[model samples]
Target: TTVLTPDVLIIGAGPSGAAAASLLRQYGYQVLVLERQHFPRFSIGESLLPQSMVFLEEAGLLDAVEQAAPEFGFQFKNGAAFLRGNERTHFDFTDKFTAGPGTTWQIKRAPFDHVLAKQAAAYGAEIRYGHTVTAVDVDGETPCADVVDEDGFAYQVRPRFMLDASGFGRVLPKLLDLESPSNFPIRRAVFTHIADHFDPAEFDRNKILISVHQQHPQAWFWNIPFADGRCSFGVVAETDFYAQFGDLALDDLLPAILASEPSLSKLLSRAEFDTPVREIVGYSANVNSLTGRHFALLGNAGEFLDPVFSSGVTIALKSASLCAPLLHRFLQGGSVDWQTEYEQPLRRGIKVFRAYVEAWYEGSFQDVVFAVEPQDEVKRMVCSLLAGYAWDESNPMNNNSVKRLATLAEICRDGRAARDALGQA
Candidate 1:
């Protein structure tokens, strides 16, 4: 057996990369983290789901997160049919998900990434800020990285394993030639932070709020209130949904959504934005194949579904946790079995999430009639499902979605049968 170089080379110093590096270091392994950007950069997807609380505790960053984030758990409002609009539907995890008062965080990507990166460094993982990974030398039996620094000096960090936790599938996937195709179906989101006096209920505990304005299937917007009295609002429009709006800028997207929703229209008409609108082409799953002999990808680098549920943080940390044990075993003279453990379950999770996202796509959730409606059973079920409760194999796979999907599927069947009979007549 030959000796290897560094224990782990983590690409992308985002939350997932930081978690993997920090955890590996905690168990006594030499880890290196490289990031293309410095700390405190602008990022999107502010609202987080409840399951993320569990993962943050695992990463030992829970305390830090609580300090930086507001105390709001999660609230699902709007998205009801006209008949049900009198009473809005909301989800308080305290009611169901009995994992001991679990609550998620609404974090700005810049500060969140900065905290995680610094924590990883403090845990003894060597972190290089502004150092980008140009290429990876996976040809060797022990895969290594061909990296370039700020000075354009190229060198090799020969590590036993490489982890690409880069959000948006940066290096490995492209190198693996994992191109995201149009059939993949993506959405264009335009978001910005606004500080104009919107008052949530008094009992909200200053916690971040996740607000979904019903637009039906074409597009839907979100409002995530942070601890700083500012709410991050973004609109997710289906591919080419904004094609006709070319004359309009991103800042106008939110106002457009508000105009379509009576509730939001009144609320935001009195508000002002704190920043310029930022746009992103997001919520698309990546090509398969996350594992190779010496390199594995994590987070969005591997699989990214719609942000409707705020599962980005949870997905990355969850995947990293799964990889941790395997990496641990290998580090301790134990064999790493990629086939039995990593590949199969990974596939299942990805498929389950994809199916769930597809449902949202099909329904379009953008219809003002359905979105701004008050409390109703179907609306409750929809919100529960959206806020990270689809009940996949990881959690208790809820029968709710299957039931709803089945009910809808049957209606389609019945309608088809009637059509056939009429044709015969």
Candidate 2:
């Protein structure tokens, strides 16, 4: 029966947890991170937004990531390509109105996450792997967590403050009963990695391909190419859509669904599965509050919108960067407002992404994206949002995304109608 104490205790070693540990350790605070899994474990969310670079740099992980990128064969990504039938549109992050890094990378989460966690360890944060936090008692002045190691050795950790970065594990949300209904419906994704023999001349390896099903607009596929000639492929659709396949092995289901998308089917026709097909269901989640006495939730521990925009890692890193400074101040015996300083601001950016995601699924934003002639300024604004500049107030698209998107969609509709009338004349 050993008791460990640290200035702060983090419940997971994912991006959010590691970022927080790295930042807090820079402020000379002792950080203890407990993780349920080992390093280099499999995870999703391969595509990254450019805005995440700032946070990584701030956490002193940029250099490590840069060195590991090439070693891991991560692909350099400057933009995203969207396709529907024969129409195609590309958004280059460098063309965005934002004033930050324009390019990011499409990485395997296993190595990317491991690199970030290792960087935190290099910064002197104590990260313990294979230690699962089973219970947390937050009623007292000092919160304590019950952790069990892989060999079933149990211990207690007492820290002045606690940060829950347990990701989809939702440690605090379930233990504290903070779960709330999400506005999004239950959706599912079937994903796998493939060794793709892509013709470099035919495919722009610098961008992720997002292809919409010609017949099933509600279903979409992601083809993220890696430098190692392997691609991460996945399809997202409503749960019922997958349920129709009912207990079919993922390997069998992948090809059947992929056949529906002609473009994706043709592109990956020469590809072979490099890993087992996997599935994730009901990933969209939310909680009533992000903070309580002595504890706050980060990353997926608090909320998750949808993966359509590839906003998960960006949001997670944003939460870590936002919460660390505030938590540092509070630990220094200063009064801190978690609601105003942390939760509200964090949710503001997430809300921006939420609006765009809603419009995307409803097919309104697609109209603007595929418009024959779109306004340059509007395109730049939308590109800024897509580049992860959701918090930039100078961009009107970030402030009123739904309204602005609707207006753009209407403009496209009118232009099409005018062309149709002229043809009739």
Measured against the true structure, the TM-scores of the candidates, in listed sequence, are 0.82, 0.96
Candidate 2 lDDT at 263 equals 82
What C-alpha RMSD separates each model from the true structure?
6.3, 3.5
What is the C-alpha local distance difference test score of each model? Answer: 0.63, 0.88
Best by lDDT: 2
lDDT of 1 by residue, 154-211 (tens): 7778887889988874689887676555245667777887874665442142333334
Clashes of each: 17, 0
- Estimate the overall C-alpha local distance difference test score of candidate 2: 0.88
lDDT of 1 at 364: 29
Deviating ranges (above 4 Å) for candidate 2: 243-247, 372-375, 416-425
Q: On a 0 to 100 scale, what is the lDDT of residue 25 in model 1?
A: 83
